[model samples]
Target: MPTITGFDYRRVPVAEDVSLNVAVGGSGSPIVLLHGFPQTHLMWRHVAADLTADHTVIVPDLRGYGDSDKPSGGYAKRVMAADTVALARALGHERFALAGHDRGALVAFRAGLDHPAAITHLACLDVLPTLDMWDVMRGTTAAVGFHLYLMAQPPGLPERLIAGAPDAFFGHFLDLWANDPSAIPPDVRVAYLDACRNAIPSIVADYRASAGIDADHDQADRDAGNRLRMPVTVLQQDWGAALGYDAVALWRAWASDLKHETVTCGHFMAEEAPADIVKSLRALLSR
Candidate 1:
């Protein structure tokens, strides 16, 4: 099993009753990396290890995911983004680079909009903003994101249904969403599965927020003239071609300075293509 070596781990409180499981390493300008769905901070093992050579790497399992506190509420991306800012500040960084994959990417997008002054640079992998995502996911094409609809339903059923056979349900994505499943070695895959299994309700709550409050919050931002002020990079699989929309154009509405690339790999780009992701982050940092 490849762990994030040389990084010290700690439980840092970002709220009254919520503390995040954080892993910090290296020393330089800071960059906080947030993990996506069905995985924990361990998803950044490859990218974090490489960046630790010159940058302060802050990796944390979002409050509901990994080893972090899983409260009944506060799963909204706005709140989650606030949790991230507090986590960074609690660790002595007032402003830093921010990057996220999947759900984390949504949170990062919110953070960029909500705390523009606090995020010097931003990167989002494999997600559209909450509003854009709901807008574009229409008709039969939306069937590909069945899980999104499943979790978005009013609580009880989604939680009980997923909890029934967590592995089979979560494993379905782990199996299908990757272009290179081998990239996730056996232990890492097991780690992801274990984490997802234990966090079903909170995970569902996280997704549920995306359907409700997260989307409403995004719509509010869109109603205003708010947009990301910092340099931004978005890397995603060519979903537009399949889903019927321009990915770059969609992102352009949200970011003033944007670099959107259509990656060839699957949705789990950070783990599936870390070298390409690292290069993009370094390039974004340079700008």
Candidate 2:
């Protein structure tokens, strides 16, 4: 009930004592789907169902969220990306197509950059890479990302502040970031809120890594001239003009063969536009 229908769920150990809560279904080529912030693998329920008809769909709650293991640290996108590659390998796939939303997209971006041989194709939804994300947010426009700064702090306060009102703190994003709130059903909304309630410290650790380690890793990769060698497709909202930056051009620097499209939906594009997500994933897999 906490997962996609017709899928089998299991805990796959990707690291020493770190197991990911994964939902897998379908057949043919494998494609691992990673979920975003304050949500679980259930975000891919609708898209997974569709992809299952043609793919071996694997959806996992990244180590810190949902029913997955939550350790004190190791939340950097680099570590999470390695976890994902390990998860896919554990699931009997040496290489596969990959897609992710929000926080997961950052992980996916790292995966594609860090594990070029393991990821055949990559798709990122509604997120900019770590360096570009910080670069674009300037002045009052940065207010939209206040949570990033909050959780990016030294840790104690952010976790405590969020834990103080878990529902309100987490629900703020579920409500504010969605163009169509109904895209996330009432039951699913409760599930997301509950997951965030239990993962305050780990979630903050994930964001905190972005502020430090993740950004440093990204900067290093940029400096090294390393790029994603696989075909990549990016789906996002119109964050360019509003944020005062060029989204596609920014992504182009990271990916060589890139297809970037702007979606007029909410931040939760997988739930809000499942068919489009499925179509995009299908195309990426084909490429």
Candidate 3:
């Protein structure tokens, strides 16, 4: 996509083999924003620009996505969380507000749990916790999550299948998950498709790790009675109630200071309902 007009783009090294493609802008308390699948830090373009008036917005394409290096492994959320924390530290922010959408929300959750002191506030958009996600995704409701199962399968098949029709596969979500098709401009849609097409294997590997290592990390946290101590805000699309579970109650178990609310929009809330997202994030940051 076009360059982020007011931002400085850089690749921040987080590990020996991994560096994150990040765009930094704004001023005041930092807010590290992580993008989800089939997209990049470009997904935060509108939101980041709006928040720049009062917050330093750091948007990064999490490892294995966008322009970031796609290592063979290390897609687990915990590892990704470490990348986020290190990215913030690399930028000279010791503690900051954090918000993530979709897969990035998983990383933010892990970051808050694993490095509570580093994240002053947390916001998760449009996802339940990994374990709770699997719990609610059963019977007919699981149908919507077919891609999750497909990507979670053994490596070879997923990589091959996605590579075969990368645009169709990735574009499907961009189409189906948006309440307003116009929200994703034609150029932005093309950018997302191109990025996903080029990063097919690494993208699938990232999802595959979730079924294995990421689940293990979530379960371990539950078993150890770990919870996010920082102020937390969750904005979702009411998937939990529709799927016969209480989303707020599920998130309550994980966050000590929690705010849960449903907003009207498709999965791409950052683009479809950016004003609402910005308002909620500002509230979270203030807390």
TM-score of each: 0.98, 0.99, 0.98
lDDT of 3 by residue, 1-287 (tens): 66578999999999999998899999998999988877888888999999999999999888988889999888888899999999999999999989999989999999999999999999999998898888788898799999999999886898888888888999999989899999989988988898888888888887887788888999999999999999999999988768999999999999979999998898999989899999999888878
- Alpha-carbon lDDT of model 3: 0.90
Q: Each model's C-alpha lDDT?
A: 0.94, 0.93, 0.90
Candidate 2's residue-wise lDDT over 158-246, tens digit each?
98898899999999999999999999999999999989899999999999999999999999999999999999999999999898888
Clash totals, every prediction: 0, 0, 0
Which residue runs does candidate 3 get wrong by more than 4 Å?
none
Candidate 2, overall lDDT? 0.93
The per-residue C-alpha lDDT of model 3 at residue 22 equals 90
lDDT of candidate 1? 0.94
Candidate of highest lDDT: 1
User: In model 3, where is the ten-residue run with the lowest total lDDT?
Assistant: 201-210
lDDT over C-alpha atoms for residue 239 of model 1: 88
Residue 283, candidate 2: C-alpha displacement in angstroms: 1.4
